[model samples]
Target: MQYDSISHFLRTGQEHLAKGPVALIFAEDDVEINTTLRHHLDLGFSKVVLFSPAAFNIAPELAEKCPRVTLESPRGEPMFDAVNAINDAAIGVWLYYCFNSEYLLYPFCESRTVGEMLTFHTEERRDAMLTYVIDLYATDLETNPNAVSLDSALMDRTGYYALARNDPDNHNHPKERQLNFYGGLRWRFEEHIPADKRKIDRISIFRAKEGLKLRPDFTFSDEEYNTYASPWHNNLTAAVCSFRTAKALKFNPGSTFQIQQFKWHNSVGFDWHSRQLLDLGLMEPGQWF
Candidate 1:
């Protein structure tokens, strides 16, 4: 159920690598580890691989179902490297990666499983799926100092936008069908977040292949995997409802005292449904009617 290290898992945990649609959850802290694990498990993933530190407390039942890899420090480059390593090992498998406290939301997810969605996506010839990381936070930071409360979660309904993704190698021409999406907590708190980390667009659901590398910027070595859709029409896009930003701002000494609250006039309670996200234009179902 657990491995001593990433290498140890790769060497002996080949059974887990045999399947498709595995979720790789990297826990930076102990926050919401059980719920996050349970969420993906409920999504019908073939395997849920958790990379967490030894000190983090995990629910006994969840610990039995999910494979936990002992990762003392899961952040920055190391996290990306681990993803790349696993990706290389599980060639052709559909892989989804996210941090703890993040939940994946696809259209009609209440009834349809993630595997079903991927099946439809694959039929359309898409090797990857674009997802927006919608920032979620507790409305009252005074009571929830960490700015994370699932019950009190709020998200900006009107802050999302996207710009052309320019290709430097192609003389700065915009990449076809690719856009650098922005907004959520990153856009609102730009001072605290680095410019490079401000984009919300991520190819979160992708098929792993030989030599596939997940970059530190949350992209892949294969440029096509970074596209938002196929050249002809719009494709399905998912949303990752996350409290990672809110938690980070409160955790960091620099921004902790500055942000007393995360709510505004435009802030609305997250309904935790794909319909609400679709109505807000956060994600699209495309041709998946």
Candidate 2:
């Protein structure tokens, strides 16, 4: 189970700093971290780092299964701090993906390596990253049953821009409105925002270049290529940048950069982050589900 050790490193650590062509970072909360760690290790990423905000609850023998893995104490802003530390090291092409345990479906959706996907984008287009969507299910259900082939399921289609118009009616039906109204006035007010106004599907992939800094403002825009979004609202407006970006923006580990209140367990963060990336024109809609 040496691979289990590697899998643990990938799932629960931070970003892999070991010298390599690529480094994979998995920021996870609660769930069996080893499952995700093992999943990504099979995806061809040799160096992996896992970051967790809670104490390791697995049995001592199971926890010790991953020797090379580095465990860091949980902090208030573990995600931001871990990412910053990894980017500071400036390893080769950094591909960052964050999701809850429920989102990752294996043998992974595609049989392709992360490096292979990035190769599709030229060096000049490094800022343009690939995006994908996770079909959330209450049980073990799939939205697309025809997804027997990873090629058909995971291919990067064209015309997938992030910040486009969305159907408000589709998102806010009478049932949704009723739930919000019954909940409180604040919930109703939150529902009043337009669907297109909310950013949803995007991911960040790039090589950390010199002088690049993560916008300390942490908020991002829904407009194409607008990297200046603030992270204070309920929207997914934070920017994922290199350690250099964190340093430039003067981001402290304990400081709160993005603030919003929502039910954390139901995949709202992933949905919001994806939308923000699309709205800012940093990602294409077709890349996502």
Candidate 3:
């Protein structure tokens, strides 16, 4: 099933949006789109809404399960606008959003479902979960020219670091429990990434509320929702292993020639396991044990 516009879909796509933990996928490219869709479906996303200009040709198998909304020049609106459009229905519901080439990873994600993770997170009295956007790319541009490979994806194991987050309210005092995270592809290829885009931390998982809005910088309008945890203590965190940046770098006509090779000394074959992300401190395991 498909809709010509977001408004129509929001009005009639009740089957998909009726439940919670909706996965909003903005399909910019068809690379592994079927697999990405199937991944979220497998993880228990009650609704999977895909917004794309061109139809993902490989998604016929799951077409009935997911609805593809035709977006004219989808890039015109920031992703948050789409989320906010359905903000009314999303209130008090678990919401997760990401692009085509990114995958959500939680502690012990391989063995658990996203619904389970959210259930546990909600039990701990948390409204949002901070996730590190760990960059993923193909080691061999020859074997994987697109810089994306579901089977043999490679990621940096030891380049992550964080500095005190400068608070907009008060520069003298940094935001409590938050940091300006850095490293991975953005750190190595700083020339391509912008200063405002360098931070890899995102609160991708959150419980939506009335008037809630996701800012362009990956934070939320509600200040507490943007915090790393509750005012008193730390909460569990997750990871988003993304190939979005890598795929963009390799596909962009300008960057393609400049980055003929992506492999360097720090490059290592990603184990494709959650343990690697946890071991590197990219994700926190607070109260998950």
Candidate 4:
């Protein structure tokens, strides 16, 4: 089903909004649209919705399967407004959002479904799941000028770090369980990237509630939802192996010429499995074992 606008989707697409664990995909471009939808559908989302401009060429079969919302401008503020509206309409549902060329990876995701992970998380009283946006790019930018080749996708195995999240309202003291995570392509090419867009941490998986708003920084209106874990112990964390950064850096004229190749001594082939991310300390199983 296709909706002409976000408001149209909210008004008449309530059936799709009825279920929990819905995957909200915002397509910045046509890059890997089909594969992105396929990955999340296979991950077991109850409903998968695509927000893309009409110009995008979506596969006929996928077009028939997923609800597509016609979004003239799908980035920045418009994207956030759409999400907030959907959150209001779909209260109590588990929601996850990402762009094209991004795939979600949780501990034991290979064997277990995303629904199973969320069930376990809900049992732990978690309202949101923190995800690291690990940058993926092709080793040879010459062959794939866009820096997006899933077959040759490489990611930084190291360089990830976290710092205390300070609260402005609380006299600069660190937040209880929240931290500002950084690294990946953003950290390495900080000069080209804007300061606000550099953080790799995103609370991508969350529960929708009344008055819940997704902030510009990719955090949330609720402080607890921004936390990495519960007060008692560490909870499950996930990683989103993405080519978004790679695509941006390579497409932007300012940085495109400067970056000859994304590969480096620390670069490693992404195995597309949970175990590799776990081994690299990119994500944690917490107490899910």
Candidate 5:
């Protein structure tokens, strides 16, 4: 089914919304939009909802597989408003949100489905999952000028760090168990990126509930919702190997010329295996063996 507006979809697509573990792909300008959709579908999402303009011209075969909705692309605060709108209507469903060219990878995703991970997460009494945006770029920028190549994807195997997340409302006392992660492209291209946008942590996967709110910083309204790990143990953490930042660096007219190349000696080929992220401590596997 198709809708001209998000409101229309919310009002009419109740059956699709009822399904759990729904993946929302808000395609901004990703050249790898199809791959993004395919990744989510392959991960066994109960339903995949796409919010993009008709100009994206989603392939016929892919469009036929999921409900497509027409939405004017958002600017300024990214997709905060659009994602929140969907979250408001997605109560009781485990929702995952990301832009095009961003892939959702959880611990041990190679042999397991996202559903299985969420099931174990739910069993641990967790309603939200923490995910870090690990920037990925093509090693050969000229060959893949768009900065996205599933075949030649590369990521920094090191350089990730975390700083205490300070709460202004609480007189600057640091939030418990929450840290603003930084590294990847956001680190290398700091001059072009905003301070708030530099944080790499995101609460992208969560079980939506009444009054649940996603802030501009990729955190939720509930304090605990912003945590990166379960209170009792070191629960699993996920990462999104995103080309969004690399795309911006290469495409943004102001910064494009400044960034001559994205590759460096530290870059390593992404083996497309969870083990690489696990070995680097980028994502935790929790109790799963």
Candidate 6:
């Protein structure tokens, strides 16, 4: 169902989510997922699922270190089907799903607990999008002062926009907020693209309770257009999508679509979807938590 405002969306039986559980799903390659799981478990996440490509390089023993981690091997099944299994079995559950490379930035641990984080207003829940700040220097955890800068050039080249930190926010919370930094520069992307388009690279967190359906024909490509498909996104950008909305897209993981289009900002589908959500009045500013 479509919503005109956060309040309207909240009033649509979405209020039931306030008491649900929250889960996080990460891919096997994501080393940061280990850290994120530790943080979440400390905050009280009861169920966390890890989906790994059968050939993932990370050692299973490493993932086993986290008590809350539950690994799922997506070897032969389609991606959506795997996600659906989690959603169906875990309905009434809130999800903060993301790649191993992404980290939670706001409502930090010292400032709030996992229980407190899940207590979002219906409007906030419906319009809320999870955003990641790239810590190019990996200083978010070490220094009290954190820096954040928006790199438009990188956005231009990689089709993804990133924020870097030169200074720090001395807000004084519990632990220094963690940053995902396995690659040369430690950073994360928030992938929130439209449902109709192809390819997405940004990390995302979703709420399973919303019941959004995903389109089975979902596919991605590097070229602008394919013989049987449309260009995913001409701009190549990504953002976090609502769990309900993401489910509605029904993306097929096993399709022959090229993974090259999956990089940040190379797929236009997410950019258009972001615009559509804003234009439809379905999204609200300051809603990202």
lDDT of 2 by residue, 1-289 (tens): 2223333544554334354334343433343355545655555554544444335443444335323333343222544444444555564545454432322221112555554444433323434342333322111114322111222212111222232233365683332101110111112222443333223333344444443443322211222222212222111212221111111112223321321221223222223233443553433323223
Counted clashes in each candidate structure: 0, 34, 0, 0, 0, 37
Q: lDDT per residue, candidate 6, 101-161, as tens digits?
A: 4434333334555445555523332312334222221112122111111121112112232
Tens-digit lDDT string for candidate 4 (1-289): 9899998999899999898899999999989999999999999999999999999988899999999999988899999998999999999999999999999999998889899999999999999999999999998999999999999899999999999999999999999999999999999999999998999999999999999999999999999999999999999999999999999999999999999998999999999999999999999899999
What TM-score does structure 6 among the candidates reach? 0.39
Give the lDDT ranking, best first: 4, 1, 5, 3, 6, 2
Q: State the lDDT at 186 in candidate 2.
A: 17
* Candidate 1 lDDT: 0.92
- Tens digit of per-residue lDDT, candidate 3, span 58-97: 4567888888887655443646678777666667888888
Give a tens-digit lDDT track for model 5, residues 10-59: 88987887878999888887488888998989988999888888778777
> Candidate 1, which segments miss by more than 4 Å at Cα?
none
For model 1, residues 1-289, the per-residue Cα lDDT tens digits are 8899999999999899898899999999989988899999988899999999998989999988999899999998889889999988999999999999999999999999999999999999999999999999998998999888999899998978889989999999998778899998899999999999999988889999898888877878889899888888999999999999999999999999898889999999999999999999999998998
Model 6: which ten-residue window has the lowest total lDDT?
220-229
Ranking by TM-score: 4, 1, 5, 3, 2, 6
Against the hidden true structure, what lDDT does model 2 obtain?
0.33
TM-score against truth, every candidate: 0.98, 0.44, 0.94, 0.99, 0.97, 0.39
lDDT of 3: 0.80
Candidate 2 lDDT for residue 131: 31
- Whose lDDT is greatest here? 4
| Model 5 misplaced stretches (Cα beyond 4 Å) | 74-78
Better of 1 and 5 by lDDT: 1
